[model samples]
Target: MKLLKVMLSAFIFYLSFIYGASAMAQDLSQQNKQLLANFANEVFVKKDLTNLQEYLHDDYIQHNPIVPQGLSGFKQFFADWFKAVPDWQYRLEKIVAEGDTVWAYGVYSGTQQGDWLGIPSTGKHYSIHAVDIFRIENGKLAEHWDVIDTYGLFKQLGVIQ
Candidate 1:
């Protein structure tokens, strides 16, 4: 009878352990989603790369069609873009995250205050819809893929002509 009680207690403990682990995983996933959202809004939209560095891995990979490469490439691109449009800001339309993957949809808009792609400043204000997918590992962004309306941007900047 004592052995039976011990076996039953072990079974209950095992079940509790499993349930506790599952709950912790769920909570971690939710926190990750919120972290991604905050990174996009506070870092990208706010153009605050100082705090952004903390959330990005050193080996970050970016798979943007225009600038396909590492995190350094993205940083360079942003630098040049910001030089031309210093006030560029993103307005997040939606964000959806599952597991370690996050998708962010937003509009990037700014006034052209400097030269871009050899085009002189037009002082034109433009907005382009953009979507970015990020993969996080160990709570840091490891990889990213982005799509933006480059054609529209070029058209607005009169660079295509």
Candidate 2:
């Protein structure tokens, strides 16, 4: 009878451990999803940088060649781009989060009215599709990588045939 009781107690403890970990993971994923949504709305759609620090860690790493590494670089890239494309807008189409990673698919549209990356303003309009992947750490964006349709963007801008 004592052996039976011990075995039952061990089984209950194992079940609780498994279920508790699963619940914690689910909650983290949900929180990360919400974080990305708010960040996109405030920074991309609204073009606001006042709260950038709240979403991005100071050592944030960017894998895009056009943009430099670190949080300061990310901020500078956007600030310059915003001036170059006054009507620039990013529309998030889909987003998925798992563990500490989040993926966002979106489109970027803008009209060039100022210089950008040595390309003078031609008043040309361009729309590009891009998929961005981000890693979250301590509830903030720690790293970023993206796949953008540069060929299509350049073709639309009349920079290529």
Candidate 3:
């Protein structure tokens, strides 16, 4: 009957729309995963900031208490740490990306030769674990959060008993 054919057509269109949306979401997630990996490598491993604008938004927001908000703040924070820990580097244990958020688990290692967190140089090496969360927007990092083992780092630095 005409009614049965019309109903079938509508159902098919609905199914196609749902499938298309799901496929698009999956593609975005995959792209986000790659973006985070590249950003981490360029920023943390390579310690290069010349191309930071390609990975981070100008109005990026930071949830970490120690670091201020915005891209300039991020660059300054890294500049200070890079000076304090000349050999600083991060080794990622795992990374997960879904929707517009990415989660990274990694260990940071370096030797302190300059002041950090107002603590004088200890001339000692330290390795600390941390988890970073990022929100991606328009192919750039828009917001960030982190949970670091500051206590362990301080203890290793001989700043705590």
Candidate 4:
């Protein structure tokens, strides 16, 4: 009777452990999705990198279509881009996440206020669509892949002509 009771207790504990692990995994996935949404709506649109630093790993790598960069490199790149497009804002269209990966689709619009990529500012408003895929690990962004409408931006800025 003692052995049977002990075995029964062990089985119950094993089931509880499995359920707890599953719940933890689900919670992590939900947290990652929420983090991505906040990143798009708050950080990217508002250009508020201060708060974003918490979620971004120090070794973050960006695979931008035009230029690849690490975390510090992206910081400088955004700084320069914002300098050129002072009124720049991003609107999130869609966001999806699974496991440790999140994908965001958005549109960036702004008026040229300073030089960018050697193109003189024309003070003209431009809109470009963009997409970013991010990988998060241990609750921090580890890497990113980005695509932007570079041709449209250049055309609007009169740099492609």
* Best by the TM-score measure: 2
Question: What TM-score goes with each of the models?
Answer: 0.77, 0.92, 0.91, 0.79
**Candidate 1, residue 95: how far the Cα is off, in Å:** 1.1
Clashing pairs in 4: none
Instruction: List lDDT for all candidates, in order.
Output: 0.82, 0.93, 0.94, 0.83
List the lowest-lDDT window of 10 residues for candidate 4: 65-74
List model 4 lDDT by residue over 1-161, tens digit each: 99999999999999999999999878877898898887776667778777657778777887764444666766777778888888999889987777888888899999999988677778989999988899998878899987888899888877777
Regions of model 2 farther than 4 Å from truth: 1-5
**Alpha carbon lDDT at 96, candidate 2:** 92
Better of 3 and 4 by lDDT: 3
**Residue lDDT tens for model 3, 43-125:** 89999988889999999999998997899999999989999999998998898988999999999999999998799999999
Q: Which pairs clash (backbone N, Cα, C closer than 3 Å) in model 1? A: none
**Candidate 1 per-residue C-alpha lDDT over 80-122 given as tens digits, one digit per residue, 9 for 90 to 100:** 8888998898888987777788888899999999987667898
Worst 10 residues of 1 by lDDT: 65-74
lDDT at 91, model 3: 97
Misplaced by over 4 Å in model 1 are 1-25
Candidate 1 vs candidate 3: the TM-score winner is 3
Residue 9 in model 2: lDDT: 100
